[model samples]
Structures are given as structure tokens and as C-alpha cells.
Target: MGYQELLQNKQYLFWTLQFVGWSGWAMSFYLGIVMWGRPPDNYGFYLPTIAMIGMTITLGLRWMYHLTWDNGLLTRVVAILGGSYGAAVLWMFSRGVIFYNAFPEERKVYEGGSMSFFSYFDGSVSAFWVMLSWSALYFGIKYYLLMQEERQRSLKAMNMAHEAQLKMLRYQLNPHFLFNTLNAISTLVLDGNNSLANVMVTRLSRFLRYSLDNDPMLRVTVAEEIEALQLYLDIEKVRFDERLRLHFDVDSAASEALMPSLLLQPLVENSIKYAIANAIDGGSIAISASVTGRDLELVVADDGPGLDLRNGRLPKGGGVGLANTRERLKALYGNKQSFRLSTTEPHGLTITIRIPLENTTDSE
Candidate 1:
């Protein structure tokens, strides 16, 4: 426990105390009749009254000491001292004129005087049990709180590890995309298309700047991802010219939606390489998104050469980005999200990605 907690809980430790003097109990209004009307001799004495009072004081003092000192050696040492408190109080009552005159005590009450030693024993044993039970309950509560804190700490560490993996994977893109775009840029420059080459270089610069500066695990809005993809297409437009075209129909509802860092780049690159690259006149690529309950259903489609379903295989190193994106969804949203692939109408390829909206925590 912290320092403040100990102080606040002290009221729980030291509050209520019961007082029983002689004849086991007392009442102010009836006190006159109880003591004055009893028979003579030992029956007139108050011994049970003394025993009860002794026990109360002894137990209370021992309880207070246990919480304050809290030492094993001192505990045993103080125990030797506990019964003495009761014994001294019992001794005073046996000799004191006040105890005999106050309460109307029976034969059994007088006999309790002979067994005053038993009161000492009862008080000492009670002190031990009270101290033991209080200590057990206190430590039990503290231990439970410790376990809950430890569990939360573990989950925070796991979340941090997943974030680091995402950031590192986002970094894997530029170098690969750079090499492919540089090849296209070189051809445009060689063909004497200086304006187009400058445009491609500028788009390339913007793409690289976004990849380099933004947080890799950030959830970029769908509008923002489209902007990045358009910049990318602008660079590719320099090389393909009239042969390549793209159709983008983004749903307004899903436009402001969030996505993992560089999530769409790899899928766009995959479609351009395998589908558009093989066609004689290249082709058109379509990107669209729609809301499905608490998730976004997004599709990237291209009208070019399609893959064979029977093979279920990439031509060579064709599936790296798709595989990585698939793994990223699993790491980020687990089973709540989905990724799918299919062949479009007569000759094109289509890839669909579904992400749950609730699990999206990052925003940019």
C-alpha cells in the first residue's frame, strides 16, 4: 500500500470499543435496583463484571499494538505482557470495595473471582487470534490488487510489441517501390519526355516524403490513402501514358475512414505488376469502398490478365505484399477483419479487404 492508503484505513483498525463493568452489563436508570437489592455475602460481589471489563481493555490494547509495531519478536514479547493487563485489572476488582458494592452478583459470579486466572488466559489467546485473522485479511486484499496490476502491465507490453512490428513492416515498402519506379522514370527520360519525367519525379518525391515522415502505425483516413495512391498513379501515368487508366469511386461514408500505415500501397502495386503489366494496351484499375455495419468493405480491381484459380499460386515472387498485408490484418485486428481474392468478369483480377471499424484506434 502507498503511504496515504495506510493513514486513510486507520479508522477501520481502531474505532469501536464496548464497556462492561460489573455483573456483565450496566444501565444508568436500573443501576439503583440491580446493586442495592441483592442478597448478602459473596452473592453481593461483582466478579463476572470485572472479568468482562478486563477482557475488553486487554484485547483492545493488544489490537492497537499489533497494527502499530508489527514485529515478530515484539509480538511474542508483547504477548507475555497482554495477560498481565487483565490480571492487574482482575486483582484490583478482587481487592477494591467499589466492585463488591456496585453489582448484585450470584454464587457463580463470586466463583469467577477464584477463576480470575482464566480471564487472563482468555484475553491472551484472543489477542493472538485477533491479530492473526486481521493480518491474513489485510495481506490477502493487497495481494489481489497486485495481481490485477501485473495483468494490465503484461497486456500493455504485448500491445507495444505489435505496434513495433507494424512500424518496421511499413518501412519495408519504399526501397522496393523505389527500384520499380526508377526503372519507369529512366525510360521516360530516355524517350525525351522531360515534362513527364519531371512530373513522375515530383510524384515520387511526394510518395517518399509521406512514407518517410508519417507514423508507420498511423491510421490514415481513406481520403488520404486515395490521395497517396493517386500520386503513385501519377508517377505510373508518366510511363504508361494512354495505355493505363484508373477508375476510383469512393463512397462518401467510407471516405473519412481510417487505415493502417501504407496499407493500400502494396495491394495497388500487386495489381499494377501482375494484371496491368501483361496486357498489350494495359487496362483500367478500379478502387471502391462501402460501409458494412461496423466495418469497411473495400475492393481493388483491375481489367487485365487474371490468375488461374486452380493453381492458387503466384507466378514467381508475386504474393509477398498480399501475404504481408494479410498478416498485418491478423496482427492488428485478429479474426474480426477479413481479406479476400477473386477473378473479375471475363479477364481481370480483384482483391477485397475488410476491416472492422471498432478496433481502429490510431488516427492521422
Candidate 2:
């Protein structure tokens, strides 16, 4: 059973252990008497009576221990030791009363109604150890369970924080992409292309609707993602006209693979901003997806003035899209995913990502 279930139903656990412990003690005492080759005529009755009395005394101890649970360590320790010793004395006195009444001729060590200090003391010596052991086990189990409960709470909090961070990263993309699209539409309006501006506005509304309707926390199939990307490209197409070129090379097997929703939108936006929008002749952007073994690989490459690699690294500034994409991937897949930036062959910049391959069927 899980610790959660055990901790939740502590009353049942206590009762079960209480019954088992006292019953086992009774059985052992009976066996020991039998080994000595001389048992009282009413041993069965006598033994059960003594065990029930011991259980009653321990129940009282359990109540006292619970009452002092929040007390200082020294106070609790004193309560345990004092409670066990006192319980042992009461148990022995009860055992003596029952024994003398059950078999009056057996011995004169304890008189039924007499109070003898030495008689109770001698019997309490052995009983003390049994009560002490019970107390130790009760506290040991209680503390262990409390520790497990604390650990469970910590883990739950951490998972909540992790999910919140992922959502923050996902939300960052929408406004950045929205601003750039609105600027492009503004440019069209300035150039006096009212007809094209109307078309772009229609497409922009559809794209924004798609973005808002779907939750950022959900995953989408590669085909679905590509369709959304087309909505975005349509808006950009009106701005660049034929100067902007696009090509998709998604494999049939990889099209149904699942990835975070809108994961590639920022990367595409980066290509349009840096590569296609800069040069006089514009440039082409290629997006491809393929599955190899257990991994799904995606590539976005643009043919334009690539990164200024004089210092063998990308130039600073204008990297929000790439950086945001990287952080989002890391948040989603942790160490199980990879994102790499490299210079494309001949020219341009390329971003490659590999994540664990998961399909719709696999997720279900």
C-alpha cells in the first residue's frame, strides 16, 4: 500500500496493529508456560484476560502520546518513558489480581486485595520492556509517515511551478508575432494597397482565432501545426509578394507526430525578420520534419545573409525568437530534447530540433 493511503486511514492501521500485537503476546506467553511443563487449569482464560488488560493500558498510553505530539522533544521523551513504566505497573497489578482470583491455591506472592510494593515491582520489570517497545514503534512509524507526507507535498509544489514556467514561455510568442504582423499590415495601408490590406486583415483574424482557441499547454500533430503555419504565411505572403519563397518537406510518417502547439511559429518569424525581409531579392525559407528511429527531427533553414560569424557566433541583439524557442523546448522536453543552431551549407542560418517521437495513437 502507498504511504498516502496508510496515513489517511490511520485509525484502521492502529486498530489492526493493536489486535495483532496483543494477540501475539498472549500466544507467546502461553507457549512459554507450556514449555515449563506446568500451566494453571484456567490458563486459556487467564492469559486472554491479561492480554486484554495490557491492550487497555497501551490504548491509554497511545492517547497520552497523541496529546503530547506537539510538545518539546524532552517533554515527549519523558511522557513516553513515564507512561510506559506507569502502564507496566498497572498491567502487572491487574495480572496479579486476575491470577490470584483465577487460581487461589497456586501461590501467595500477590494477595487479591492487598497492596504490596515488592510484588508489583518484580512483575513490572519484564512488563516495562514490552511497553517501551510498543511506544518506540508507535513514534517511529508516525515520524516516518510524516516525513513521507512532507516529501510528497514538496514534489507536488515543484511540478506546479514547472508548469507555470512553461505557460509563461508559451504566452511570450503570441504578442511578439502579433506586433510584427500588425506592422506589416500598417505598411500595406501606407502604400495605398487597400484591397491587399483587407485580405491580410481577414487572414490575420483567422490566425489569431486559431491561436486563441487552442490552449498553449496542449500538443498538436505536425500536420495540424503546418496548417496553422500556412495561415501565418498567408499574411506574410501579401506583404512580400513573390519575393518571399516557402517550401515544406514533411515526411508522411512524421506528419502525425505530436509536438508542442505553435512551437515552430517563432522560428519562422525569425527567418522572415532577418533573412527574407532584409535583402533586396528576398530569400526562401525551408521547413522540414522527419522521424528517425525513436526521435522526431525538425529543421528550419533560410537562404539569405546568414549570421555574422566573424567571431564564430551569432551577432548580439534580434535573437528573442530564437532564444524564446530554445527556452520553450527546454521547458517542454527537459533533457530529452535537443535544439541546435548552425550555419546552413553555402549560406543562411539553420535551426534543428530533435524530440522523442510520439504519435496521436501513442498519446492516447
Candidate 3:
């Protein structure tokens, strides 16, 4: 069994500890009686006998320890120590009885309450120390294991929360996108452009189908994300015609980088809403991506009026799009990714995003 699995098996741990402890006790007894020529007893008989008795007594103590294992801290301290000392006293008395019976002649030679009593008391103290040590180790390991399990549970909860947040962010884009497209279709129908309206409706259906096909948590390649954004732009293009000039400047190396599904749509939609929709002569929306080191840098820039920095209020660009994008990036990459907005040198606003370059499908 693995170390963690073995540590969790109380039965196995108890028996293993009992065997090692009693073996050590037997070795000490042999050293004193045989090697040092002290006590001068029959080592062969006494060693195995004492070891077996020690193992049996500790086994009973092990059962008692388990009974009080799950109690409150104070109660456990009292119960375990009390049980250990009681078991020690009982074991010492039993050993004395056995030794007396085994060596009747030696017992008869001993005077009343002298060497015999001291020896028995010494054994009781030894047993008490051993049991005390065992209790400390048992509780220590149990608490460590409990803490590990608790940590695992906490991480699981955090991941669930992250996923819920991601879903919420993904959902936020849908309603805003739908409202704009429906309004566009309404405008086209009112202007007697039925063919364009019909085409826009078809593109909208395809875009929605693509969004529905991919899960919110699915990690998509940069190429796939771009395709989905293109579907969205197609619907908008029909309404604006030559006025909406869309450009893609994605590098071939960065095209395979993995990202959250439909991550860039909101940025593009924001550009259309704040830039293209406001301009009578239309504007240019550019989406570009490049790889540097282990990072993928993406920028969505549009030529528009840009943000008004004079007044306290910012531009209409920083709406649900910026907020949702920022939240999603935080949820997915934590502190590893960056998203920022800045006005272009001459005109328009630019949204820059930097994320880790996870190129392989399995890397995600």
C-alpha cells in the first residue's frame, strides 16, 4: 500500500506498532538478562514469554484507544491517559504473577515488599511511558490526515465557485448580443431591406448555434475563438456593409494557443457598439495576436472617438464588455493573465490581453 493509504489503516498501523514495540522490549530484556549476565534468568523462556504478554496487553489498549479516538480534545486527553495508566498497572501486575508462577523458588527467596515490588513498579512505569508515546503519535497522525482531507475539500469548493463564475460571465454576453442583433434586423426590415434582414437572421442563427455547441468551460484554440468571432462579425457586417471594415492579423504560431470559449466576442462587440455604430462614415476594427516567450498577446483596436478623459465620466466603451472580460480572465487565469484598456495614439480605443501560451490541446 502507498504511505498515505497505510497511514489511514488504523488496524494495520496498530499491529505494526505493537510488533516493533514488543520486539524492542524483548531485545532489552535479553540484553539485561543474557548479555550482561544480570538477573541470570533463562533468556530463551523469559524473552518470548514477556514479549507475547506485552503484545497482548497493548492489543487490548489499542482497542480502548480506538473507542475514545473521536471524542473531544479534553475528553480524549483524560480518557486515553487514564486508560493507558490503568492498562499499565494491570499489565505490570499480570507480569508479576506470571514471573512468580514461572520461578516459584526465586519468588520464595524474595522478602516482603522489597525488590519484587520495586521491579514490578518499574515495569509499570515503562509500560505507562510506552502507552503515552503511542497515544501522542496516534492523535498526531490522525490530525494530520484530517487536515489533508479538509484541504482537498476546500480546493474542490474553490474550483466549483470558479466554474460558476465563468458560466455567469459567458451568459452575460448573450443577452446584450441578442438585443443588438434584433434591433439591427428590425432596422433592416423597416428600411425595406428584406434580403439583408433575412441574411442577418441566418448569420445570427449560425452564430448562436456555434455558441450553443461549445461549453462555457471548454478550452478553445485561438483559431476556433477567431472563427466564432468571425461568425458574430458577419451578422454585423450585413448591417454596415462597406462602412464596417474588419481585419484579422493573427500570427500562425499563436493561432493554436488555448483560451476560454468565445472569450473575444465581447471585446469585438464593444468596438462595434462604441466605435462603428456611432460613426456615420464607419470605422476600422482590427484584431491582432502574437506570441512572445511563453505568453500570447492579443489586441482589439478600433478607430473611433475614443474615451473622453476630460470629464469625470469615461467612454461608453467600458461597459458590460470590459467588466465581463476582466472577470472571466480573473476566474480562468487568476493572477497569471492581464487585461487592460488604453486609448490609441491618434484616435480610438485598444483592449490588450496577455495570457499564457498553452499551445497543445492536452495542455489545457
Determine which window of 10 residues in candidate 1 has minimal summed lDDT. 14-23
The runs of at least 3 residues in candidate 2 whose Cα sits more than 4 Å from the true structure, single-residue gaps closed, are 1-3, 16-56, 99-123, 190-198, 308-318
Q: Which of 1 and 2 is the better model by TM-score?
A: 2
| Model 1, span 40-112: residue lDDT tens | 4443334454445544555564565556555686664454455344445444544344433554453247556
Ranking of models by lDDT: 2, 3, 1
Against the true structure, whose lDDT is highest?
2
Task: Give the TM-scores of the predictions, in the order they appear.
Answer: 0.64, 0.82, 0.78
| Highest-TM-score candidate | 2
Ranking by TM-score: 2, 3, 1
Q: What is the lDDT of every predicted structure here?
A: 0.67, 0.87, 0.82
lDDT of 3: 0.82
Per-residue lDDT, model 2, residue 158, is 87
Q: Kindly list the per-residue Cα lDDT of model 3 for residues 1-364, writing each as its tens digit.
A: 7877776786786678668867887787677666655553554686677678766776676677678777787877787788778878877787787777777667766645356644766778887886677667666766887897898789999888978888889887899899989999999999999998999999999999999899888788899999999999999888788999988999999899888888889988888888998899999999998998989999999999877653423346558877888889988888999887788768998888999888876583
In model 1, what is the error at residue 233, expressed in angstroms? 1.6
The worst-scoring run of ten residues by lDDT in candidate 2 lies at 109-118
Which one wins by lDDT: 1 or 3? 3
lDDT tens digits, residue span 92-155, model 2: 8888777767876665544444645346568698999999999999999888878877888998
